[model samples]
Structure formats: C-alpha cells, structure tokens
Target: MDKSSYAGSPADKRLRRILDSNVGLCREDAIWALDYIRKKVADGAPAMQGLPQPRLMKNYQSFAEAAMSLLLSQRSGPMEAERLRKMLREALHGLIPD
Candidate 1:
C-alpha cells in the first residue's frame, strides 16, 4: 500500500501491539516502532520529541554496510559487539523495506 494509507492501516495497529508487548523486544521492533511513530506523526502529530531520526535504507547491502561500519567505529569487545551487530543486521535486513 501507499505511504499515507500505511500510516493509518490495520498493519499499523498490529505493529503497535507488537511494540506494546513486554517480551521478545529487539532492534527490528524498535525500527518498526520508530517508523510507524514517524508516519503517525507525519500523519498529524508534532515531530517526535527525542526519537532517533530514521534514515532510509537504500538497499539491504547498504543497510548491512552501514551497521557494520557503525559497529566497527564503536570498537566494542567481542560479545557486546557481536550482539550489537546481530541486532543491527536483523533490524535492517528483516524490518527495512527494500
């Protein structure tokens, strides 16, 4: 569906439900919540107060590259670093629309 309709659709409600859930939270959930939140705001409300601004993913590869680049720049230790990378990959690869 179109962008405008997507903002108000039942899919949006289902997304919200997923977001509201207490368990199984992940980067993908946050990404979708952020996206729909932005869309909802653009549909009427004011800009998000403290939310991270969304960057459009050019493609899956670009999204992957960006995440890897960010993680590399951060230079965390192995375990935390791996988790961060996984979260970013899932968020970008799974949630982002091509």
Candidate 2:
C-alpha cells in the first residue's frame, strides 16, 4: 500500500503500534477466531446498533488469508503493513452480494 498515506496519520500510527505489540494467540487460534466470527455473521447475527454486518462473510477464507498474511508480515515495515491491513479491510468492503 501507500506508506505516504499513513506517514503522518496518528490513527494509523496507533494502529501500527497495536498491530506490532499485541500478542497471545497463534495462527491456528487466529484462524479459528476468524471462522467463529464468520459463522456468527453468516448466521444473521446483528451487528452493534450502528455498525453494519460484514460484507464478506461468504468469502471468509479469502478474508482469513488476508488477515493472516498481514499478521505474518511483520518485517514488511509500517507502510507495507498498513497496506496489508487496508487490503484486508477493502477486501471485506469490496465484496458484492451473490
């Protein structure tokens, strides 16, 4: 992604820090967690009052892969990391209904 976009953004920097420092779960666990979330969304679970349901529930595998790719790419630096993160989000947002 474009590192320039996030260069001076506080929110992106905070997100990068959080992504960099957070830990506990392993890859398999992360996959399981994502699967659980997908199942919940696919089952027609309501989002929080103001939030919309995720648009990519049916494409869970792709979404999960993108997430894992972002997590596993720690050495890619903040700009690339942000790109991956944005890619994951955009992949979710870009899905069209069947």
Candidate 3:
C-alpha cells in the first residue's frame, strides 16, 4: 500500500491509529482493514490497473476483509470459532482467480 495516498485521508489515519494503539476485537480489525481498502481502491496508478483484482491490489485487503467477516460472524462461542476455523481453512485452500 502507498503511504502517500493514504497520508491525507483522515479515515485511514484513524484506522491505522487504532491498529497501532491497541489489540481490539476481530471486528475492529475488519473495520480497520475495510478503511484501508476504501482509502486505496480509487488509486489509478498503472501498477494497480495491472492487478487481477484491483481492489485486491494489496493482498492485505483481501486477506483482512475475508478474515474480518468470518471472525465477526463467529464471535459467539467455541462452536462458532470451530466452524469459522473450518471455513477459514477451506478459504485458505480455495481458488484465486487469475
């Protein structure tokens, strides 16, 4: 991710600060990751245009968004954690488009 692009974005600053200051819940991480993506999704740099998934131009975006949703939904208890673990495993082994 380009630091310069997000440098001016207040949303990005808030999210980054949150990540840096504390270890919040998975939902918070998801929110942070989402803000990160929102900050960069509009960048029209040539390298980003070449990517297979432009929104995923930064691999962290895909990883974080997926992780956040899965983690948040399974926050109820151990059973949910186990279920999410399985889902996360399957996701890791799943296909990525070219």
TM-score of each: 0.30, 0.33, 0.34
Model 2 segments more than 4 A misplaced: 1-22, 48-98
Give the total clashing residue pairs for model 2.
0
Model 2 pairs in collision = none
Question: lDDT per prediction?
Answer: 0.43, 0.44, 0.42
lDDT of 2 at 30: 35
The per-residue C-alpha lDDT of model 1 at residue 90 equals 40
Better of 1 and 2 by TM-score: 2
The reply for model 1, stretches above 4 Å from the true place, is 1-22, 45-98
**Residue-level lDDT tens digits of model 2 in 1-98:** 23343344563443333233232223443344345445545665443222444544434554666677846765555555454444444443322111
RMSD list, candidates in order = 12.0, 9.6, 9.5
RMSD over all Cα atoms, model 2? 9.6
Query: How well does candidate 2 match the true structure in TM-score terms?
Result: 0.33
Poorly placed runs, candidate 3 (over 4 Å): 1-8, 21-23, 26-29, 35-39, 42-68, 76-98
TM-score of 3: 0.34
Ranking by lDDT: 2, 1, 3
Write one digit per residue (lDDT tens) for candidate 1, span 31-89: 55445544554564332233344433332344355355454654444554345444443
